[model samples]
Target: MIDIFGTLGPKCDNEIMLKEMFLRGMTGIRINLSHVKLFDCKDSIDRIKQAAKEAGTTPKILIDMQGPELRVGDFDGVVSLAKGYYQTLGDEWIPVDEKIIRAMEPGDEILLDDGKILAQVKEVKGTTAEIYVKRSGGLTGKKSIRIVGKEVPMPALTDEDIENLKFASEYGITGIMQPFVRNRDDLLAVRNQLQISGCPDLRIYAKVESMEGVENLENYINDCDEIIIARGDLGNAMPLWELPGVQKRIAKTCREHNKPFMVVTQMLSSMEKSAVPTRAEVSDIYNAVLDGATSVMVTGETAIGEYPHEVIKYLVNTANEADKKIKQNKTGE
Candidate 1:
C-alpha cells in the first residue's frame, strides 16, 4: 500500500484527529520541528502513539529536522518593500546568522519566499546591512532566504536537534527527515549522532532541497532510507522552469539505486483554502506515485488547512489510481 503521511500541527494534533486519519488510510505522521523545540514535542509524540493503538493501526512517527537551511527572522505581518527602499537588518528586518549575512557582497542577489520576492545588497555594515529592493514586494516574515552565488555555512545537526536526539530512541521515533542534506557527510554525521544518542534504529530520510544536494545526490543515496525531493526550496536554487526536470532526475536516480523516493510540495496546494483540489494537483500526485514513490506526504494541507481530511482523500485516491494501473500492466488485465 502507498504510505500516506500527514503533517501534525494545530488542526490535527489530538488523539481524535490522529485516529480519524488512520481510519481513512494515513500510514504515518510527520511532526515538523522547525518552529517548535524537540522536547516540546514529547507530548504530541506520546499522544500519537497512543492514538495509533486506539485506532488499531501502528503509524510511524517522522520527525522533520531543520538541517543547514537558512531562514530570515520575524516581523509583525506583511512588511512591504518599495523600490529604492533601504533594508536594515535587525531594525527594519530581523537578522539571520552573521555568517549568511556577511557572505553577501555588494550587488549580490537574495531571494526570499522561495524566489517570489527579490532583494539586492547595497552595502554591509557590521551585523547590519542595507538592501535595495529590485521591485516592490511584500514579505510575510520568517521565510527561507537564498543567497545567490554563496554557500551559507551551517552544521548538519543543530544544537537543539542534538538535545532532542538523547531521547529519540526512548520515544521510539521511526524516522527523522533531515532538510538541506547536501552530501554523504551529512548523512554520516547525522547517523553517528543518532547512534551516539542511542537511536541507532531510526531511519534517515534525506530532503534534497538545494542545487548542492541535487549535484551531490548520488553520494548520499545509499546512506538515506528515503530520498525526498523538496520541490519548494529546491526550485529557488535554480531557474524555476527547470524544477520539473530536476524532480524527475532525482526520482530516476533514486529508482536506479533501489531507494524509496518521494516528490513533495504543492501536491494538494489548492486544497489548503478550498475543499476541492485542482486537476493539476491530482495529476501531480498521480504522477508522483507512477514515478515510483514508496510514500507521499501532505504537509500544510493536513497541518493547517481548512480541509485536512479531504486532502488525504484526494491524495489517497490519486495514489490508488496509479496502483491500479500498475497492477493491470503487471497482470496484463
Candidate 2:
C-alpha cells in the first residue's frame, strides 16, 4: 500500500473529521512541532487516538521535529514584503538566529517561504541584516529561511526538539521526521536522543531539505528508518526548475536502496481552498506513485485547507488509481 499521511491542524483535528480521514485511507497523522509545543498537543493526540479507534486503524503518529532548520519568528499575520524594498532581518522585521546574521555577507542571497520570496543582503549591522527584496511575497510566522550557498552553523537538534523527544512516547509519537538532516551525525544525534528518551525503537524519517542533505542522502537512507523528500525547503536549496529532477533522483535512490520514502509538500495544494485539485497537482501525485514513492503526504492541503476532507479524497483516490495502474502493469493484465 502507498501509505497516506495528513498533517493535523485546526482544520481537521476533531474526532469526527479525523475519523472520516482515517476511514478514507489516511494511514497516519503528522504533528508539526515547529509552531506548537508537544505538551500542548496531548489533547489533540487523544482525539486522534479516539478517532483511530472508531475508524478501526492503528494510525502512526509522526512528529515533524524542528531540528536545525532556521525560520522567521512569530508575527501576528501575513507580512507583505514588497519588491525593491529594504527590510531588516534578525530585528523587528523578521527575527532569526544570530548565526544566520553572522554567516551572511553583503550581497548574499536569501530565500524564504520555500523560495517563493527572494531577498539579498544589502548590509549587516549589530544583530540584524538589511536585505533588498528581490521577489515580492507574503511572509508568515515560522516560515523557512536559508542563505543561498552557505550552511549556517546550527545544532543537529534544537532544545525544543530535545524536549519533544523526551516526551515523545508519552504522546504516542511513533516516528520522528527530523528536518534539515545534513548527515549521519544529525541522524545519530536524534537516535541517541531517542535512546535516552527510552523510545529508541521509534522510526526516524530524515528530511532532505537542503543541498547538504541531498549531497549526503545515501548515508541518510542507510541510517534513518525512512527518507522524506521535503521538497518545500529542498526546492529553496536549488533552482526551482530543478526540483522535479532532484525529486526523481531521490526517489530512484530510495528504490535502489530498498528504503521507504515519502514525498511531501503541496500534493493537492489547489485543493487547500478548492474542492478539487488542479489537473497538474493530480498528475504530480500520480507520477510520484509511479516513481516508486513508498508513501505520499499532504501538508497545508489537509492541515489548514478549507476543503480538508475533499483534499484527502482526491489524494487517496488519485494515488490509489495510480497504484492500480502499477499493479496492472506488473501483471500485464
Candidate 2 ranges beyond 4 A from true positions: 75-78, 91-93
Instruction: Report lDDT (CA) for all predictions.
Output: 0.85, 0.90
Tens digits of per-residue lDDT for model 2, 13-132: 899999999999998989999999898899999999999999999999999999999888888889888999988898777888788899999989999987889999999998999999
Model 1 lDDT tens row, 225-325: 99998898888878889999999999899989999987788799888899999999998888888888888998999899987878888888899999888
* Distance from true location, Cα of 65 in model 1, Å: 0.9
Candidate with maximal lDDT = 2
Any idea what lDDT model 2 has?
A: 0.90
In order of listing, the candidates' clash counts read 0, 0
